[model samples]
Target: MKLTNKITIIALAAIAAGSFLALAQTPANNNIVDEIVWVVGDEAVFRSDIEEELQQLRAEGSALPPNPYCVIPEQLAVQKLYLHQAKMDTIEAPEGQLNNQVERRLDYMEAGLGSREKVEQYFHKSYAALRNQLREVMRTQYIIGQVQENLTKDVKATPSLVKKYFAAMPEDSIPYVPLQVETQIIMVYPQVPQSEIDAIKDRLRDISERVNNGESEFATQAIMYSEDGSAMQGGELGYHGRADWVPEFSNVAFQLSDPKKVSRIVETEYGYHIIQLIDKRGEQVNVRHILLRPHVSSADLEKARLNLDSLRNEIVKGKFTFDEAARYASHDKDTRNNRGVMMNQKTGSSRFEMQDLPPEVATVVEKMQPGDISQAFVMKDPKRNQDVVAVVRLTSRTPGHRANLAEDYNQIKEMYLAARKQEVIDEWVEQKIKNTYTRIEESWGNCDFRYKGWKK
Candidate 1:
């Protein structure tokens, strides 16, 4: 389960302030003892809870906040408030979706800590016991998420409010806006010769036959031959959405209903893949595939370059608009629909930060002015792990500067809305605490809490 966007900042800050040495280190001869750290309403926060969270945050290299012991218990108490509200409201994530999330979390932990066995050992619990504990944690996290969303559902900012907020900030304190650019591209994927395509299909067919005949297991074959990163994990890509996959791969993968059946060779931008369905949970699925990419010949590469050049010429000469050309001629599925304007996945903005830009895209963008079209060039597709030809157009550019209301209205507006939302949550918390039966152990009340109402 994930925290809602609104509360994650507060949650992280509160979480980082504490240390749980016992959770971080296990002594060989000593028994681990957990005690009640705080009590909120009918719920109780345990020392173990703080330690587990602290251990995970520390492992992620997050900076610790001041007075963690006091800070973390307060956060836990606040979390319990939301969870209690969630119960009163009868809120819950779907059982299937919750189980999927649980398995995925376990998979990530296992992969990171080396293996499932190692994870169990580190936690000092059997797999079943650990799963049960994680289920409760995930359930509470989701409930808290629902509460956060409900609290801030009406929060918004107007242009006037945004301007006022920006005006109120000291000039020196205004955030620095980084250099950003909006780029458009028409990509040309080299066509694999029929012979090369046929060769790949033949090889996949052989592997399929081997798996069907019990001569080899699908995961075993994947380990020996799959080119993708999932090969190391026996080709198990944990539960993911249909949108996460290319059309060709997802179409064939979602069609396989039987665990024992191997799918036909499916061709996507990545390459030829033979899929094995591990399981399905609602709309999401867990599947494994072995990817085999065919070699693109020099002639094929030149052909693609020439084809893209023709499209670029049409766009540059004003015979066709760049967006028109991109819609009809660009082979990139991700960008073609939106007129080739590349979206920054990190920021969800049309403008890309320099460091976040792909090396090939950055090189062309550096030399081009806004509205300048680039010549056909070879660049690597990071996702497909293949080289292809493309032509780019730099649509817009912004120089680094201190943010102002005129140019950074959205950014300032977001800040204003966040501050307003925080105030609303704080007021709500004060009322909740006054009404709820809360008793914090006196020993836990010594730290400087951002929310003083917690002491009441």
Candidate 2:
């Protein structure tokens, strides 16, 4: 019983900013009990924290032991381990990212249970205070992840180990995998009108100069002018890696030096931007920026449609195959470069599943037969505030059901990689427990631990 309790606690703590502690329990009288339950290094665990966690679990209608208090010390012990590892690794996450994460989570929680106002009433704090608390907790959690990753990075499990692990699992425990594909792609962005591009760049330069001349604070200006969703929070991109951002934005953002100064106008597939550097350490950099995009012309769009329409007519008249016209007559170099093979971004497969088609194209292609060309339809990109005319060809279709080894190899490979990573991490945690100075309050002695050496 103790072993089961310990495992659950450790698993829960391993997730970022995960806390039952955020929930407030309904006791006979008060919810905020200030009593100390356990202490780890300099960190003290409170009875209220456990009760709050219990409240959340019960609210979710989760089954729990009648003796709920028995797990209190177990949770404390797990937190102590996580906190210690976090301190050693110096892990950090940005305040803005943490805040957004918390807000979205709270929103989901509210939808599931109650509103933020009610949540605050239960916690005895404002929404702002709760955000601050979660941010700090997440920061510590990041450290723990960093330390665990560093420790496990070298402990690779081989193919044989994976087969062994799979064989040990019960038949019912294996889930039917879904259809998935994986492919690598090099995207070619369509060329933007030179005049339109210049105009956006000019507008950004003007906005930057206004900030430079003391017109407004960079964040405030970003809030007013930035096109990204982060603009709501003063264009704070939050702490993220280069892979998270579009290539053009990432390229310029990493190059800027001054946090307070504005960057040169930059163009990306998304649109145009004037960026301001925020902070950097190692490979991570935070930035705030504003985007400006020019509107598309109806006249210009009709011109493109008329041109493509004529080319399509020529194809039907037997002058050329659709591919031949696509290579020479299409204005969009992105599709033209590959003879017009549209790849699904998520799956990276050359063949798009029905749902994989873009919304605008999907509506048209649903009624289309293979080898049929869709009439030129309009689609708008929010960043660019421009409508583009595109024609989709229904290349292939597959019925959905259980995934196969051949069709879902990439998905299976990812799952395999994840399982191996977890095994590596488990070993690493066992080692960390062995080396770290740990003193679990007498209450946790009954809990079974995978790391037997920690008993000392």
Q: Best candidate per TM-score, number?
A: 1
Kindly list the per-residue Cα lDDT of model 2 for residues 28-52, writing each as its tens digit. Answer: 2254655555554455555555665
| Clashing residue pairs, backbone N/CA/C < 3 A, model 2 | 20-53
Q: Which lDDT value does model 1 have at 288?
A: 84
What number of backbone clashes does candidate 2 have, counting pairs of residues 3 or more apart or in separate chains? 1
Q: Which model scores highest in lDDT?
A: 1
Number of residue pairs clashing in candidate 1, backbone atoms closer than 3 angstroms, sequence gap of 3 or more or interchain = 4
Error of 1 at 442 (Å): 2.6
Report how far off residue 107 is in candidate 1 (Å): 3.9
Tell me the tens digit of each residue's lDDT in model 1 across 388-445: 8999999989999998877777777778988898898888887888888767778777
**Runs in model 1 lying further than 4 Å from the true structure:** 1-34, 51-61, 109-133, 240-251, 280-285
Q: Please report, as a residue range, the 10-residue window in candidate 2 with the lowest summed lDDT.
A: 180-189
